[model samples]
Target: MSLYSRKAARLQLNLRKVAVKGGLAIGAAQAANAALQAAFIVILARLLSPADFGLTAMVFPIVFFVTMLQEGGLTSAVIQRETISHRELSSLFWINAAIGLALALLLCAGAPLVATFYHEPRVEGLTMASGGLVLLGALAVQHLALLNRNMHYGRMAFIDVTAAFVGFIVAIAVAAAYHSYWAIWLRGFVTIAMTFVLAWLLSGWTPGRLAPVSQIRDLIGFGGNMTAFSLCNYASRNLDNVLIGKFSGEVSLGLYDRAYRIVTLPLLLINAPLNRIITPVLSRTRDQEERYRNAFLSTLQMGLLVTVPLMSFIAGNSKGVILLLLGPDWIDAAPICAWLSVATLLQLAGNPMGWLYISQGRSRDLMLAGVANSMFICLAFVAGLPWGALGVAKAYAFCAFLSTPLLFWWATRRGPVSLRNLVGAISPFALVAGCCLVVVHLLQRSRPDTGLLFLMELLTASYATMVLTLSVTRTGRSCLAQAWSVAVSGFSMMQMRKRSSYG
Candidate 1:
């Protein structure tokens, strides 16, 4: 073979190796995180009241909005910047710090008002205690972005997994001993402190004073537009919880919040990593429109390959699954979980498209799309409030479905992913899910006495295995081979290191 051909082959091998390592690291980290969180929730659910969970949930959106303000898209600006100066980085850090301080103070001040609105005076103390979480979150924001930009996902994964495990352990311990909402608040507090500590240790970068006055304007011009879009996007995403907490009271909100958490399980495992990895990768290729398009489509296809069947099986067997995981008291959340699964599936579709627009520096397009969607969703919430949380869930799902086309159009206009191609890629998974649902229905009719637990476990396992067998026939096997090779090599290397150390 020619020298050039050999070089090309070597490069391909290296790329595959990197992808495999990254995937494994992310997959392992997410699996660990999910397990710890699931354990925490199970323990907390039994120890604390739904009203305690609801109170915690009610504070989340406000804290989230405050976090958005602190973020102000500066981290993205730092990551996507062609050339980042020390001055600029320091300026960004302080900007975040200042905003965080202000946000904390504001949250503390508004504690009483928030408590009054919720008709629970206890919320004042809860809100005040949770206020510092925003500051902690802001302090770590830019550092985490810097880690991402440097492709230090292995370190990022370590920090994340450690923090989650620590937080979970603390939460469970606190709940078991105290059995109050203090456990929930302590979890947030621990998470923030660990985040700051990890970011500082892992990033190994320190900042000084702000940059030149001129730098601030340019950075904000880019970041401000992105932040505006993020604000709307955050609102659209969290509006249901916002409304639920306001109209339905804390206990109802707790039930719905728990259900929503269950619904986003697949999303937490799959979409979270994609959302992290895709932006920087896409940003590097933003000038190459074809590469950008292909990468977007491939990520979308891969995301759906996992998300679709997972959502389908979970939704189709929500009753049994909820009972199994959350126990008998949460049977009420079963239908809500089912309804939320649909919204999450659509979210799986739309999330990567945000990466596309952001990588292309089309922040205004994202902002506009976000605004339009938020408005429609807010209208839906107003119209659906009379029917309660179920109506709100349906409204949110409907809004998500309506917004899918808008997202598709935005992505397609800028890339080569046709609507037909997108639909075609996901068809097989959809078909499998449809078949599984049919089988479920038939089995239920024939064996009317079949337990919810048996049916849920059977359907989930059966459908998931079918999807994996069909989808992974070629690509999945290839990935598995690469993963196995990597694992074996890593094990061998560790053994050699131990022998060398002894010698």
Candidate 2:
């Protein structure tokens, strides 16, 4: 090959290498997080009443809203920008800190309103306690963004896993001792604080003196658009909880919240780490159209491979999973979980489109899309509200399924990615996962027993079927081979590092 071709080939190989390593690192970290979260939930659910969970859940949306304001998407702007200066970083940092403090105080002041709206006085304390997360989250945003920008997935994963572990320990201990909703509140506070401290320690970049603030106006503008998108998105997603708490009461909201948590756990584990990895990687490769397209397709394919099967399994076995995890009191959440699992499955297929918009500087399109999506979601929630939590869940899922195609079209219309490309990438995995889901659903229906063994049998059959089918196909075999190679390389690299340290 000529020198330019050789350079391009090398760059492509490097990208693959980084992606593989990053995926493995982040995947492991997220898996650990999932486990910890599951354990925390199981333990806490047993200790606390449903009303306690519902009370805590009511405060989450408010805290999340404040958090959106505090970060203001400045961190995303930092990562997407090809070049950034100390002055810009410093200015953004100060701006974030100011926002964080202001929002934290605002949450404290508004705690009473939240309690009054929910008709539960406990919510006020929870809201006030959770306000500190805003400042802590803001402090760590730029640091985390810098790490992501530099492709420091391993370090980022370490910080995240460690923080989560620490938080879990504290929460578990506190719950064991206090046996109150304060466990949940303290968990959020401790986790955010730990994350902030570790991010600063590992990032090793300090803010220099702030320079002329004029340089960061464009950054602020970009971040503002992102923040607007986030606010709309947050409202769409959380309105259900707000309305449920208002209309249906705390106990029902608790059941619904738990169900939602169970269904979305897989998405949390898969989407978060990949998003952190893909956004920066795609941002760097935006100029290379073919590479960008291929990279995105591959990532989407990988995501669907995991999400489709996992969600299908969840939907098929929702009753067993919910009963087993959350106990009998949460039985009402089973149907909700099943429906929401299907919804999440459909929603996840279109999740990676954000990378395209953000990386390509299509923030305007992203904002508009968010607005449209939020409106649809809010309407669905409202339509389902009169029917209670299950109705809301069903309505939400139906709307998600209906709007998913439109979401894909809008996200891909003006970008390198297209609907055809997306369908092509995800079609095979979707087919395989669909077949597995059918078999699993049949097995569950035939057995009609919700026990640990039955659940295990269903999971095993589903996974084995998926594996056999995938192994039978050339495309599936290639994906498996690539995944195995990455896993082996990651293991060997860790082993070598351990040996080097010993020597």
The model with the greatest TM-score is: 2
Candidate 2: pairs in clash: none
Worst 10 residues of 1 by lDDT: 475-484
lDDT string for model 1 (1-503, tens) is 99976875575455444444565667679889888877777778889887898888888887778888899988777767777887788888888899999999999999999898878888788788766888898889889988877767788889889888888889888898888887988887897789899999999888887788797786787788888887887787677777888999887788888888888878888888876776777776666555556566666666666666667767666776677667788777878888887778778777777776677777777777778878887888777777888888888788787878777776657555566666655545455556655565555556643365666566666556545555545544443354356568556655776899999
Candidate 1 residues lying further than 4 Å off, grouped into runs, are 1-16, 416-421, 440-503
**248, model 1: CA deviation in Å?**
2.0
How high is the CA lDDT of each candidate model? 0.75, 0.86
C-alpha RMSD of each candidate structure in angstroms: 3.8, 1.8
Off by over 4 Å in 2: 468-478, 488-503
Model 2 lDDT per residue over 94-130, tens place: 8989999999899899899988887889889888877
Best by lDDT: 2
